[model samples]
Target: MEAVQFSPPLGYVFDPTDCELVGFYLCNKIANKPVPGIDYSIPQYDLYGSEEPWQIWNFFKQRLGEERDDQDLYFFTQLKKKTSKGSRIDCSVGTGTWQGEDGGREIVNDNMRVGTKKRFRYENKDSDQHGGWIMHEYSLDQHSDYVVCRIRKSEPALKKNKRGKCQEVDSEKKKKRSKVQEVDSEPLPLAVPPATSRTAPTTTMVQQQIQLEDETRGF
Candidate 1:
């Protein structure tokens, strides 16, 4: 099978952690033969040149139950670009995150809401200074006519409670049931029947006298 190749969008901003374009390069296997320069500049290439790009795009979109639009194309292009640079990327669509100050919204603190407005920012872990901030607004809810970029939160660190313990609580009924079972398993005292006295019955004297009279009459 011919290997798949992805090309990045022109002049795309690179992000290490949250960028989507980077993911495509890592996933798709590149062809061994050099791609002609003309192919690179084209808006779309034959995923399997035998098939149309829209057809392949539609196939994926159908499987994902997503609309295949310009945003999706742009997203794929960006992914291709990111991969070319030796950065890592994911194959699946995901919630994207924008870090740093540039292309980011102003930090808003209100009674109900407080946080930086949704914006793309750059952060460098290696640098001594915190990365520069840029502000830009994005329509996360809207599907992009060009390329849709979705932001998502990264994994958060597990935090310990005040007592440095994180324990899951069981229902009260379960605790009671366990206690009952434990008590039932232990040995218990055996019950004994109470003792009772018996009395003997006496024979009637009239019956004995009658028997003696009958014997005397026979004599």
Candidate 2:
């Protein structure tokens, strides 16, 4: 499949919930389903053994033309494995190595473990500035056979209090629904003249003339 770019929505950022990431986006990707009205979105790409973090960031920024103020980046990628039966992430990618921040965090769906989210910091061999680069690795269940990762700058403030920002989008959606209901329920009044003055009385009887044996009777 061709790589489709994902542009953030106007006046909002792309911060999907854990449930949405697993249930909606990843499920549809696994099913090869196309999302409507979304021409460009997180492209399906394998990042494990690909270019370095900076290269990946630059490539996406060129495609996006503008960086999201939120600075959180997302991608849909297939997990890299050491062997068909082995369970290890192949660490050989570009110039530097990817290091996990903490032990993987369990991302739950419907009270069941669906995937693991791991934070990574890129340590570039040539420069110390690369240490600030961060990536979020969201690997699905072993049965899923696929993964989606989010890349971003290392900022502790952005990660904290993120759920509150997500709620803003929800509130906007509710307001839209209310506006639609109000327009639908409000009746439209049409100008109508009074019925008695506007309408003429109908003629119920007509004079009739009958001739029988040269005699005529009128009632």
Candidate 3:
């Protein structure tokens, strides 16, 4: 029998609500305060650099060893003006550009507007092809120059049946147990009937039946 190989657990998930992103992360970042789990969760990066969207994706995907294609990436990026004298911000990549889809959306926390989030789509420089990549740029209301951005592939390259983290863990455990059972060569021991026993059920049998009934009720 072959030993089953188990993969490592799917690490922390970085999903945060819009309010949390603005009130906690964006605010802390602007204030130069320590943000918990920022290094592993949302790292600082040059989002508007020369690298294309796909190139950035491959780099991080390899570095992080993330198997899921549907996960979103969060980053702290500084916005740069188009020119030294111009007030417009540049959103161009190497050969692609991030075209804004909307003006801006207010991100409110505790009935107070904390920041603005705007959506962008990556488009090729010389072609009409677009929408393979998406980004949500978040900036503080007071400090709009520097912002936090969330990037994600609009459509996943690899598509599979959706499963939760708990489901994946349970599946791995079941596979390990099955492999162990197969490797064990010990013979089963036969159970002997009690002396002078009739058709009456044992206390253990009643307890197991009751437990099964309780489990069935859950469904």
Winning model by lDDT: 3
lDDT of each: 0.34, 0.67, 0.78
Candidate 2, residue 199: Cα displacement in angstroms equals 99
Question: Could you tell which candidate, 1 or 2, scores higher by lDDT?
Answer: 2
Each candidate's TM vs. the true structure? Answer: 0.23, 0.59, 0.64
lDDT of 1: 0.34
lDDT per residue for candidate 1 within 117-188, as digits (tens), equals 234432333322112222222221122111223322211211222112223234566788999999999998
Q: How many backbone clashes does candidate 3 have?
A: 0
Which digits, one per residue and each the tens of the lDDT, describe model 3 over residues 1-219? 112222323776789988888778988988999966676577777888898787777777666678787888887889989899999999987588898999999998778888899999887734323557889999888998988888898663212212333577799999999999887966788999768657885668889999999999999
Q: How far is candidate 2 from the true structure (C-alpha RMSD, Å)?
A: 23.0
lDDT of 2 at 205: 35
Off by over 4 Å in 2: 1-12, 37-39, 142-144, 155-219
The residue-by-residue lDDT of candidate 2 on 18-100, one tens digit each, is 66776677777777798763234566666776576666777776666656534666788776678889988765447777777
Pairs in clash, predicted candidate 2 = 5-40, 5-41, 6-40, 6-41
| TM value for model 2 | 0.59
> Which residue pairs overlap in candidate 3's backbone?
none
